[model samples]
Target: MVNYASGEAKGELSGAEYRRYSRHLLLPGFTPESQRKLRSAKVAVVGAGGLGSPILQYLAAAGVGSLTVIDADLVDSSNLQRQVIHSEAAVGTPKVASAAHAVHALNQAVHVREVPEVLTPANALATLAGHDLVLDGTDNFPTRYLVSDACEILNVPLIWGSILAFDGQVAVFFGDEGRGVTYRDVHPRPPEPGEVPSCSEAGVLGPLVGVIGSTMAMEALKVLTGLGSPLYGRIQLYSALTGDWTRLDVARRAGRAPVTEIEDLVETCGFPAVEASGAAPVRAEVLSPAEALREAATGRLLIDIREESEAAEGMLPHAVNIPKTQLMEFARGERAGVGPLSEVGDLHGAILHCAGGARSAAAQAELAALGISVANMAGGYVASVTLRP
Candidate 1:
């Protein structure tokens, strides 16, 4: 026998809360009772970037009792486009700190626990346990699988969302192995490494993330307040170009094994094995950005391994624009006629760079496998520009 009408789950709201959530309190179906449910809810949000930005903002504003923000990444200038919780001054700050600051500003009554560490298989369960629900905003596959698995073991609902380019998808998974669907029901296996391009590689529209993130927050509110049917067995897809939304139903796979415990997700997802059994570690020759610039100035070959559009923004004056795709093709000896690599003879001792250092590092590995010695510019173009002064 629970009395919800008085809105006293944790305790009665203060006069300030009544004013702050007055609109919600006035809704016909939703009374202050629902607001109390929201006030008693505890949510864990993974990845305090893009989708996490909106999810955290709205939930804190809606007065979620507590939020655990988990992320290891630091704020960068690029994130400001859609990670609206952070400011220009917050760049180089840990994302969780910036996100917690924003949450406090929005609602001081909401408690925030900022864990500035990457969620790994070793700690996923410990980090995510005890929360009423988990919202996933991470951009990669392995972490997604890890979070979903951890939720399954914890028997918590997962509010999941993803955005790439102009396309976004949102879904709710209850992670109850037999009764309802989980992320594994939707994506039984993770995509192979390199099969899917990251937002950094493919580029994403900033506003698209806001739409998906806000939708995710709305879904979380519904689940927390028991207001309406949640998207437990459905996935919603949005196309900004077409301005249409489509919903598809998903179900738990029959006889799908329950997730008993978390395992090494990186290995399970088939990411490149970090160190093979007893094999010598292969390290690429690295060059400081300053040294790479000097080499480029002296007319040494410098290959910009980013895509054509990225190179057009600003590239080293003497750098050749051989995109990562073309470079990989050349590494595989599948050179096309009139390929960009053909414009420069002998890539044996060239330097490679990208907007950041990741693409260049991947490209360097591919070239190294073909016995082509190339030096990767540490920190890539970003560091190069910083060192210019």
Candidate 2:
């Protein structure tokens, strides 16, 4: 039988630790024993952003013996809104480094390991191995699916949290024990790329991450110490607007094949693949920001597909703000020649750009299929501004 509650041998708490965790020690079911289990626990947290900020802080404060923080992105000024672990000084630095510093500052005794690389199929298993528990705070579907599959294969408990707009969701998936369901049990397949707007497009409430991350952290303590029931086979959902939390049960899919290996999900969860009919792949005509700007100078129209809020910050010299939804509706004929693009004749040869270009690329693909010829500004507005002379 697999021992789900324990891992490495427990360690004795020091005087300072006892003082530091006196509140935890005083709980009836939780005493020195539980604190010792925590002291011996090793945890890996992927994506030290909004959710990760609180999860790492609470876990480190609770004295998780070792923590591995993995992320490849650098801190941006925009992240300061919800990613509380990083400060103004951390801008432009690696997220893992910033997160590690925060963890150490909170509790110097807790050992922190920083993996400053994007977790990939080649490295997910090796990077995640040896950790007793893994918390996924990554924002994208591809990374979320990757982490879940890796954890399922490793037989480690995974606490997953997602936040968007005024809502959030948290779930615990334990493939080897405690209800025996993985993330795939709830989400059999990823949604089509761009089907669900990102937090960037949808916009999230800042403190919403705190509520979800703290819940995940609380669930982590329960799983580590066996102090309470974890959210196995169920997901907890939170709504900031409604001020309510709801729980929904999830069951393992019957006859679902187990994840034996990690594979790149870029095609599955990110970009679309070629059709089986051997039709030409629908790829966007891409041009670098600088190249697109030169074309725009000559007469090619440049359209900013980012939301109005994002465009408010800045935009290209001669770009017209047409949000992705409005432009796509016009392309698909959903707007019936009545939307923002209705007045603009001849979309052919025009260029579409977003914050970093991913959305615009997706929009370009759909638009191309509908016979709307357009180009995608490869680096989008951010890159265009940087290269603008």
Candidate 3:
């Protein structure tokens, strides 16, 4: 844990640092003292994708002393759309390594620790400990929860940001500090699987990641240097399409228990759906893409739960388009087979698919809980086409 107490010896700024951070030092309240704080601060950044790109870049440029970059994915060509930190040459390289190299290039004075592994409950605490602050740029629900929980248990200050489809949100959580707000205070539980589309499915504006990531980085500097009011207990929301920004206040839930331990939520918040309650767990039936096609040929209804935008491109031969959000609404009894699914009365024994099959597979539990007897097409449309016989 970082010693937040005052009167700690401040680090001295070098002649080059003075020249580099001249603008920051010139700020009214941000003096050489603040610059020194930044120089001495250590921050842990989770993820090296879209949001992580800008956060790492800005923070590194600002001269943060040590950065621990954690990510497990390799750079894919598809990531070039919004992940600005990595270059065409970085494709197939580990994201953390690429991020570390980018950081070193941006500010050689800053130390970069690259952790090329997924942050799991088993290692999250040990990995994040000792940093003055932690930032979460991860895309999934499970990692978001895990990071927040680890911060809570470790009593670290945390800044979190998320982006989806031209929209972004930023919030600061200081577990056991100040207002004591945590991410769980804002999101009581992860959204149900497949209720929301991922960036791959829904698509996001490239600049929106910058807007949110930079905002988070700004909040981090403020927290580190006491420059201004941090966004603690407040969440900033931005919409690129509308060019609008809004703020929401978050309060710690009264009587909510503080997180004492991390729990494995791979099934609940990962690809699989939340388990159904009963004498036995109701699991979604999963079928390979080939099997799904075969089943579809045998009169089983095939549904493609990708967004309308994606379905506009193409879909399986026998698959009906019933966007995931709308399908979940129907599963939750919000509507009675409205819209494109209006004519499809029964979902029983239907085979659901998405572009890569994860989204449709994630919808399994909810549909299964309703006794719909649906099977998810593992690996989705891509596999269906590639593996077709």
Candidate 4:
């Protein structure tokens, strides 16, 4: 929804404005005035992982005045495949700071702010307020809802993206846009209690994130500059396996609870339904590949939570190699209805492994959150190799 204020005021801009945004101004039908508007646009993105990588990269490349990134994670070696915003040197650095610096590297003219904290209700308002757009690259439901409800209350647009195994969704929620729909419009209730798996729980395809994230950035551009058709009130799905694309036009839910604040959203959605926040953490059990081999023989599930490509290199003899990106969707597919108990079925036992211990541990914990019981292979895939001569 274009909300250009009427009457009139398209004044001449400054020299730096012309110089800083000269390229954009040079485009046909995109005058210096439009460049200035883009140069003045500010956006805040939650989470700096898979989707956030390309989202931030493109926004900075476009010179979107200011970019603020909020994330409490640290870059891991495993993330190198997908979370492209960070590099080898940034492996141990804070994600927000690392991502901010990465954006600055792309365009020094753009101001970057790093909020190195988990987005919570208290700071949700401050984090979102004053920004022209908020991007949701967050991984979990609790945080996703936090950003969504905050945008809804502030009456701003939220550019959202989600990647599950191989399928992904992109949509723009504009509580302020004309009778627009919010996140609730698409999937009213969170996935079945045990059905939604997370990024760490399942792995993601590195470039796949770029595909969805860059598109989200483009959507942000459309919403910010009124340049093209917005994704608001619309949903786009991309599938890697089939290389198919689908778009769904959506509308608001009938008689849904009015969303005023993040808290109301928490209550309305019955989120934190099982209290993942305060629940005691689960312990991940790790094992050597030899140890894993022994366990797999007992009809146990060996889940490889690495990215799709990485898993293809090689996995345990009987491992079920569902990449992280497909985890959430996998849980909801027929597998959950017929697979092992620890996974789709009520399996008696399971083992989780990743390239490194961190990703596997993360995957283990995320699945455990969905009530999956499994042991984490401590040393990860590298620990599984046979000794060479």
TM-scores of the candidates in the order shown: 0.79, 0.83, 0.78, 0.67
- For model 2, residues 142-219, the per-residue Cα lDDT tens digits are 889899999989999999999999999999998884348988888888877567767766778999999999999999
What does candidate 4's lDDT look like per residue over 1-389, in tens digits?
Answer: 11112211245666766686677777777776566666788789898988999999998877677778888777877778899888999877788878877877777767777788878888989878999999999766767777888888888899999997888889999886336689877777765322555555466777789889998999998888888689877899999888888999898988776587566343222122221335765334556667787787787778787777887777777787766556645554534432333445443247777764555555555656666556667546754543211
Q: Model 2 lDDT vs. the true structure? A: 0.82
Among these predictions, the greatest TM-score belongs to: 2
- For model 4, what is the error of residue 303's alpha carbon versus the real structure, in angstroms, after optimal superposition? 16
Off by over 4 Å in 1: 1-9, 268-270, 274-304, 312-321, 332-389
Per-residue alpha-carbon lDDT of candidate 3 for residues 94-209, written as tens digits (9 for 90 to 100): 88888888888788777788888889988999999999999999987888999999999989999999999888999999878424899989889877666776776677888889
Q: What is the lDDT of residue 166 in candidate 1?
A: 94
Residue 127, candidate 2: how far off, in angstroms? 0.6
Candidate 1 lDDT score relative to the true structure? 0.81
Model 1 lDDT tens row, 1-389: 11112223386778988998999988878877788889888799999999999999999888888889999777888889989999999988888988988888777777888888989988999999899999999987778989999999989999999999999999999867457788889999776444566777677899999999999999999999997888989999999999999999998889898888887755434233222234544545778788898898997789888889888887877788888887777666677533435632377778988875667766665665566667888657765654543
Which of the numbered candidates is closest to the native, going by highest lDDT? Answer: 2
Cα lDDT, all candidates: 0.81, 0.82, 0.81, 0.72
